[model samples]
Target: MSNVLNTFLDENLQDLRTQGLYNEIDPVEGANGPIIQVAGKQLINLSSNNYLGLATNDELKKIAQNTIETYGVGAGAVRTINGTLDLHVKLEQTLAKFKGTEAAISYQSGFNCNMAAISAVMDKNDAILSDALNHASIIDGCRLSKAKIIPFAHADMDDLRAKAKQATESGLYNKVMVITDGVFSMDGDIAKLPEIVEIAKEFDLITYVDDAHGSGVTGKGAGTVKHFGLQNEIDFQIGTLSKAIGVVGGYVAGKKNLIDWLKVRSRPFLFSTALPPGDVAAITRAVEIIMESTELHDKLWDNGDYLKKGLIELGFNIGDSETPITPCIIGDEKLTQQFSKRLIEEGVYAKSIVFPTVPKGTGRVRNMPTAAHTKEMLDDALAIYAKVGRELGVIQ
Candidate 1:
C-alpha cells in the first residue's frame, strides 16, 4: 500500500478510537430473527429492520428456493441489456399495484433507487427543499443532482412552508422538489406528508417520499403515503424490498410518465445488473401476502406498543415515537454506549447511536421491535433494560 494511504487510514482510525466514536460490529451466527446468536450467546435482538419478520418466513424461503431452481442465481446483465427478466417485469408491476401508482421502476437496492431516481428527474437547473433529518441517501442523491439544496427544520411545517414559498418565489430555478423520509428511522416519527403535500400544491413543487421504514409497517402494509391517502398526490413513492419485504431491492413508484423517464435515464438501471430472480420472486410473494392480509402488520404494531409501554413504565425516556422504532435517549455518548454494552451483557442487542447519525448530546440506544418477537421475549428484554437502567442510574 502507498505510504500516504497508510498514514491517512492510521490517523483517522486513531482519532475515532480516541474520541470513543468507533463502532465494533458483532456478527450474528445464524438467521437474524427475534432472538439472535452472537459470539456463541443468544440475545434478545432489537436492532434489526426486519419489521414484519418475513425474512425468516417458511413460505418466502420456499418460494425463493423454487425460483432459484427455475431461474438460477443472477440476472446476468443490466436491465437495459438482457437482464430484464420476466420476473423483473412482474416485480415492477406488483410494486406499482402495491403502491397504487400508474407504474414503478425497480433498482438493485433502496440506496441505488435514490441515486438513480433523484438525479434522473432533477438537475443543475432545479432546487430541492429537503428535511434537515432526511436519510443520508437522500442527501447524496440531492448532491449528485447538483441542484441547490435547501434544508428545513425536521418536521417543522412552518419552516417547510416558509422555505417552499421562498424557493418558489426566488425564480432562480426551473424546478423545485421536496424530499423527506416517510418515517424518520432515528426518531421513529412519521413525516407530516399531508402537510407537505399541501405545501407542495401551494408552491407547485414536486413531492418525494422515501418510505424505507414505513412499507409493510404502516398503512395496512401499503405505506405512509397510503396511510394518509395521498398516494395520487405524491410524485415519488420510494421503498425498499430488503426491510419489511424480507427480500432485496428498491423501487420508485409513480405516474407512468415518471416511471418511463426513469427507465430510460436512471444510471443504476442503465448500468447495474438487475436483482436476482429468486429474490424478485420472494419479494413478489411477500408483497402479495402483505396485500392479502394484515395479520403480520397488526402483530408488528401490537409488539411495538407492548415494548414502548414497558420502556415508558420502567422510566426510560423513549422519545416521542409515532411508530414501532424506539429510541431510549441517553444524553452522554459514553454513557449511552455503556448502557448498550450493559444491555448486551444482560442478553439484549440494542446498539448505541450517536453524533453524525443523530445530533450530538442526544445519543440513544435504538430498539426495533419486529412482529416475530413474542410477549415472553419482550418481557425478558424489558427486564434486562430495567436491570441495566438501574445499575447505570438511568432509571429508578
Candidate 2:
C-alpha cells in the first residue's frame, strides 16, 4: 500500500479508538430471535429488526425451503434480462396490495431501493426537500440525484411548509419533492405524515415516504401512509422487506405509471439480479401473514410499551418513541459505549448507537422489542438494565 494511504488509515483508526466510537461486531451463533447466542453466551436480544418475529417463523421457513427446491437458489439474471421469475411477479403484486398502491416494484435491498428510486425520479432539474434526520440511504440517494437538496428540521411541519413554498414558487426547478422516513428509527418517533401531506398539497410538491421501519408495525401492518389513509395523496411509498417483513429486499409502491417508469428506469431493478425465488416466495407469504391478522403487531406494541415503561420507571431516557423501537439515551459517547458493553457482559444484546448514526453527545443504546419477546424475557432484561444503570451511575 502507498505510504499516504497507510498513514490515513492508521491515523483514523487511532482517532476512532481514542474517541470510543469504533464498533466491534459480535457474531450471533444461530437464528436471530428473542434469545440470541453471542460468543457462546445466551443473551436476551433487543437489537434485532425482526419486529414481528417472522425471521424465524416456522411457516415462512418451510415455504422458503420448498420454493428453493423447486426454483433453485438464484434468479439467473437481471430483471431486464431473464431474471423475472413467477415468484418475483407474485411478490410485487402482493406488495402492491399490501401497500394499497396500484402497482409496485421490488429491488435487491432497502438501501439499493432508495439509491435506485430517488435518482430515477428526481434529477438536476428538480429540487428535493428532505428531513434532516433521514437515513443515510436517503441522504446518499438525494446526492446521487444531482438535485438541489434543501433540508428541513426533523419533523418540523412549519419548516417543511416554508421550504416547500420557497422551492415551488422560485421557478428555478421543474419539480420539487419532499421526502422523509416514515419512522425516525433512532428516537423512534413517527413522522408527521398527515401534516406533511397537507403541505405537499398546498405547494403541489411530490410526496415520498420511506416506511422501512413503519411497515408491519403501524397502520394495522399496512404502513404509516395507510395509517393516515393518505395512500392516494402520496406519490411514492417506499418500504423494506428486511425489517418488519422479516425478509431481504426493498420495494416502491405507487401508481401504475410510476411503477412502470421504475421498472424501466430504476438502475438497480434494470441492472441488479432479481431477489432469489425462495426469498421472494417467503416475502409474499410474510405480507399475507401481516395482512391477515394483527396478532403479532399488537404483541409488538405491548412489548414496546412494557419495556419503555420499565426503563422510564428506572430513570432512563428513552426519548419519544411511538413504536416498538426504543432508545436508552446516554449523552456522553464513552459512557454510552461503556453502558452497552456492560449490558452485553450482563447478557443483554442491545448495541450502542453514536455519531455519525446520530448527532454527537446523543449516544444511545437502541432497543428493538419484538413480538417474540416474552414477559419473562423482558423482566430479566429490565433487571439487568437496572443493575447496569445503577453500577454506571446512570440511575439511582
Candidate 3:
C-alpha cells in the first residue's frame, strides 16, 4: 500500500486509541445469546439485538441442522438466476404471512435489503424524506438511490409532516418518499408510524419502514408496522432475519407489485448470492415459533422492564427508551467508552455509542435485554452497574 494510505489509516487508528475510542475486537468463543464467553470469560451480554432470544433456541438450531443436511450449505449464486432454493421460497412465504404482507423478497442481509429496495424503486428525480436518526443502512440506501435525501427530526411527526408537505409542494421531485426505522435502535424509541402514514397519505408520499429491530420484538413478533396497524399502508416493510429472527439475511414485505419490481431492478438481488438454505430454514422455523406463542415476547418485556427499573433505581441516567434497548446516557464520549470497557471487565458486555453514531456529547452505553435473561442474571448485572456507576461518579 502507498505511504499516503498507510499514513491515513494509522492516523485514524491513532486518534481512536488516544481518545480511548479505538475498539478492540473481542471474539465470542462460544454461542452468542443472553451470555457469551470472551477470552474465556463468560459475560452477561447486554449488547445484542436478540430481543426474543431466538438466536440460541434449540428449535432454531435443530431446524438449521436438519435443513443443512437436506439442502447443503450455500445458495450458489444470485437468486434471479439459479440460486433460489426451495428453502428460500419457503422462508419468503413464511415471512409474508408473519409480517401480514401479500408477498416478500429476501436478500443477502438486512443491510442489503435496504440498499436493494431503496434504489430499486426510486431514482435521482425522487426525494427521500428520512428520519434523522434512521439506521446507517437506511442512510446508505438513500445515497444509493441517487435521490435527494431530506432528513426530519427523530420521531417528530410534525417535522416529518412539514418536510413531506414542503417536498411535495416544491414540485421539484418526480416522486417523494418517507423512510424510517420502525424502531429507532439507539434510543429504543418507536417511530410515530400512524402519524407518518397519515402525513404520507396527505402528500401521497411513498412509505418505507425498516423494521429490523422491531421484528420478533414488537406486535408479538409481527413488527412495528403491524404494531401500528398500518400494514397495507406502508409501501415497503423491510426486516431482517438476523437479530430476533435467529438467522441471517433480510426481506422487504409489501404488495406483490413492489416485490415483483424489486426482483427485476434490485442490484443486490440481481448481483448478490442469495441466503443459504440453512439460514432460510432457521428463519422459517423462527417465524413458526413466534407464530406459535407469545411466551418469548412476554419474557423479553419482563426482562427489559426489570433491567430498566433496576438501572433507574441506581440513579444512572438511562435515556428515554421505550423498549428493551436501555442506554446509560454518559455525555462525554471518552467517559462513555471507559464505562463500556469497565462493564466488560466486570463480566457485563455492552458497547459504547459515541459521536457519528449518536451525537458528540450524547454518548451512551446501550443494553439489549433478551428473553433468555433471568432475574438473577439481571440482578447480578444491575449490581455491577451500581458498582460501576458509583465508582465512576455516574450515580451517587
Which candidate has the highest TM-score of all? 2
Against the hidden true structure, what lDDT does model 1 obtain?
A: 0.95
TM-score of 1: 0.99
CA lDDT, candidate 2, residue 37: 99
Off by over 4 Å in 3: none
Residues 1-396 of candidate 1 have per-residue lDDT tens digits of 999999999999898767657788999999999999999999999999999999999999999999999999998999987999999889889999999999999998999989999999999999999999999999999999999999999999999999999999988999999999999999999999999999999999999999999999999999999999999999999999999998888999999999999989999999999899999999999999999999999999999999999999999999989999999999888899899999999999999998878887999999999999999999999999999999999999
Tell me which of candidates 1 and 3 scores higher on TM-score: 1
* Candidate 2 TM-score over all chains jointly: 0.99
lDDT of 3 by residue, 1-396 (tens): 999999999999999778766767888998888889999999999988887888888988888889889888988888988999888888889989998899999988999999999998888999999999999999999999999999998888888888898999999999999999988888898988888989989999999999998998888778889988899899999998889887788999999998999999999999998888888888888888898899999999999999999999999887878888899999998899888889999989998988778877898999999999999999999999998888998889
Give the per-residue Cα lDDT of candidate 1 at 181: 99
lDDT of 1 at 15: 83
Ranking by TM-score: 2, 1, 3
Query: Candidate 1, which segments miss by more than 4 Å at Cα?
Result: none
Model 2, span 1-396: residue lDDT tens: 999999999999899988989988999999999999999999999999999999999999999999999999999999989999988888999999999999999999999988999999999999999999999999999999999999999999989999899998999999999999999899999999999999999999999999999999999899999999999999999999999899899999999999999999989998889999989999999999999999999999999999999999999999898888999999899999999999999999999999999999999999999999999999999999999999999999
Error of 1 at 64 (Å): 0.7
Model 2: lDDT to the true structure: 0.95
